[model samples]
Target: MTQTPRIDVVGGAYEEWCLRPAWHEVFGSAGRAASAIAAMAGPSKVTLHCYADARTAQVLEARCALEGTRLVAVAVPATCSFRYTHALQRPEVEVPQSTYASVVVRAETVLRFGMLEGDAVVHGKRVVYDPQGRLTPEPFGANGSSADELFIVLNEREALAITGLAEGATALKLAEATRALHKATGVIVKRGPLGALVLDGDDWTEVPAFETETVWKIGSGDVFAAHFALNWAAHGHSATDSAYRASLATAVYCDGRGFPEQSTLDVFPAMPIRASARWMAGRQPRIYLASPIFTLGQLWLVEQVRENLRMFGLEVFSPFHDVGYGSADDVVQLDLEGIHNSDLVYAVADGMDSGTIYEVGYARAQGKPVVVYCENESSEDLKMLEGSSCVLCKDYVSSIYRALWTAMAL
Candidate 1:
């Protein structure tokens, strides 16, 4: 019998809460990655190294035991926790703070790196990571000195921080910049719905994201990193091929809000794999926000959608924010100009607002991609949109992701 490979995951484990979709889950980056690794490890061995409070440690211990993985959790005063109003919104610190001691675990073959804390600017307010959130002085080879391969998975923000690259850097640029740092053998930059960029040696590869009916954004990166490490380090696959498999795993996690089992991955539907030169060029699509803003609820929804789009580094033209309330002639011409200038239209069609509907139709006529978010609208009312090839989404998170993916394809 072949000796089983052992993978070590080093990162944070905390509590997560979402208000809009009403979700409560424990495990930050480390725990989530370990769960994903265990789900597909088969005969391989997986271990999680993290610092957590008593409650978090208990939860993680039980979860690891159930998944047939080993957990090496250091007891901390408290576990970091966050609460989010929406899946796309920045989370607020729910639990006070925790001090993490350095954890040293040797990986037999693969090691994955993730962050314990991160900084974010939410609604113009900057929320910095707590000083005590550091798990070690450096993560590169500290936790997996015995491993032959190391992979670092990060979002745009983390990559920027690591490489000291300025904001607005393209995925390829970020990957190349980080390559000089030499933190890992392979660096995978997760770009959410826009997919990921994998950097191995001097070459960069763009991995396309798969489509899913529902998207639960939380912990998706952990799933991607875990799967990528499994395919690349454990199975000896190429970096680009591993990243593609990771993208599929991410889609499964987002759609079901759970880690996919090995059997599910084996029978997963065949997906197209192609390089997108447009995305590689960093040509971000301009988006036109078409929605009714007369009522307070409608205005709130519009703001949420616009903010989420902007969060992804997208340029959005909102009539309410840009044009404001004005005479019909002035507003109509300006909105039309915005649509004409945009590459895609993201319309809120919950109430089938007339102006929004018109904008959608006009955008389609202008050969622009349109993603419509329709929750309560009847199918009869959306017949024209459906017939015209508008991408319709019924949920908030999925709608935002669909809009981003659709715009990226253009």
Candidate 2:
């Protein structure tokens, strides 16, 4: 009888806190990845190597026990933590350097920060070495170790940092540059929403990210790398196929904020997964912000929406920011022009402001997609919006993500 394969995951474990979406979890890259791998590995055994304090170690040990994952926690002075007001905002707390000494790896198939001797995947972290210091992208395999077969997964910024390529480099160019620098067998550059670019040997494949009704962006990349490692390194799947599966797994993680079960994986291929329209057009979509901005409270909400949308890397045309306060005749035409130029309209429908209602109606008339955040509004007030094919959401985070997805689909 054949023994089950053992997969090793070596990375950081820390505290993650968010405000708007209200999330508090005790998993950084290693913990999340190990959980995902264990969930999908079936009969395979999984081990996680990470640095953590006593409190974190205890929490991780309990979680591993529940998930049947082996925990190898190295004692640390303090477990690093990050706080975010929203998923798109930068972490308020600093991420201290966790790796003081080299972590020894003995497993044949490992997911790690750097290269291992056998089949391995590497993911670099953007962290600060000192408190109150700026974050820097840590290079992968900085100690010069190489693997028999290695895969490197990185975001666009990390790819540019590692390859020393100029900004705005094409995915294929970044992949080629990384291969030239590291001699990696495979390279995957993750483009959020736009999907991923995978290069194996001389072939290139584009993998589309599965759409989710709501997005929890934190740790989604870790889930992707974990799934990819499990499929490509442990199961010997092709790079492109592994990446496609990884995308599906990431969508499950983002929507549910938990590891996916085998049943979801079984049904994912049959589900409708459409590529983003922005991806096909090779340009970012513009969003027209329609909201009341007269009072202090209204202005604050409008600013919050605008900031969050911009943080998602979208081009926002906010009337308050762009046109400023003016008479109806002065601003109405320009506002309508902005709506005409945008790909979608995101309106805050609280209090049923007349201007916001008119803007939503006009956007619908022009056949542009509209997402309305209608908290505290009565059903009667939202009946027309619900009837006119507008996506209505009551919560803040869901409303924002719904608008983003709607724009991308357009």
Candidate 3:
């Protein structure tokens, strides 16, 4: 294994050294097929469509030229169904909240090359890279030419220490591999149930065949790949010894399951969960509990709102019946007043009540969070809150707490 062969790694260059290979080796069959995806790799542009005979539809015209792939927007239903709740209103001609939807699509041929955490094996070549802060493509050349390669340094000390954070491989496992293959020449192949293989240059030196006790495979390939890279790159290890070492490492990853990590642990952790409410402990939340002041449900919920906010130490504003319903002659002015008061609006859209619907519209018009709480599980009213910063509540108790937290953080 003199000069390493040139290979190109594709897919999102995510994780340390694209440890995905080690992940597959350790996790086997599971990691083999599923591809990794990230929203950070954004679409080229955004487009907005607000239907109104094209002239008055500012939503469409405003973004058509400016935002061409990822479109963030407010959707309005063709009409607001008044039957959904008490006094609910969705005028056939008026702007509906459901009419907005977000669509983000990558251009047909876009490739995102994140800083190389490690090398990627496309064919049977060893590709080197230098890490560059930039996230786009660059030409591959010698050390000085390659962008600062985030790709794993086959001979570097950190290789073994850098197992996937979420992947089950502990520092011990990584250390063991790193120490043994320090100056050796080999390729580690993480085989699913098949165990691992150590290949020197192109030849197999050992097969740490996995146990026959288990039935699943995952991350096994990743271990195999890492071992292979190390062994192949090690100074003096023969092609034969490299393969044997890779196989041995794969065996440990199998852990008698014959498959791999008992838990479906992957090279990468699952995506992080986003909170329903934007409220946080330090910052205050601008909340809009746009509900009827007269309804018992709305009133009962409002009292809890203050209590929940106290848990996180947050302040919120709710425009209840204070608008003085029949007393107000100008509905538009009354609605705008609520939006102008707060930074965000949380609508109680249960029953799709007209008053609640009006508040949601006002929130949208003001570009504020229109968080909604829906008491009934199955109601068209739920449709009214989709995509907006609104949370549709199914269970009042838990959702109430959740709403407060989410709103304040926003």
TM-score of 2: 0.86
Local accuracy of candidate 3 as per-residue lDDT tens digits, 298-392:
68766655455444445556554444455566555755675787766656655677767877876777777655656564655456467555655
Pitting candidate 1 against candidate 3, the one with the higher lDDT is: 1
TM-score of each: 0.82, 0.86, 0.31
| Superior candidate under TM-score, 1 versus 3 | 1
Candidate closest to the true structure, highest TM-score: 2
lDDT of all predictions: 0.74, 0.77, 0.36
Q: Encode model 1's per-residue lDDT on 199-318: one tens digit a residue.
A: 887788888877777888887877887887777776778889988988898888888887888777777674533325785576767899999999999999888998899876678999
Worst 10 residues of 2 by lDDT: 126-135
lDDT of 1: 0.74
Model 1, which residues run further than 4 Å from truth?
1-3, 95-98, 110-148, 167-173, 191-194, 202-204, 270-284, 362-368, 380-384
Sorted by TM-score (best first), the order is: 2, 1, 3
- Misplaced by over 4 Å in model 3 are 1-282, 321-326, 330-335, 377-379, 387-389
Name the candidate, 1 or 2, with the larger TM-score value: 2
Worst 10 residues of 1 by lDDT: 120-129
How would you encode candidate 2's per-residue C-alpha lDDT over 149-196 as one tens digit per residue? 777787777777767789879999988887666557878888776689
Per model, how many backbone clashes are there?
A: 0, 0, 100
Quote the lDDT for 178 in model 2. Answer: 73
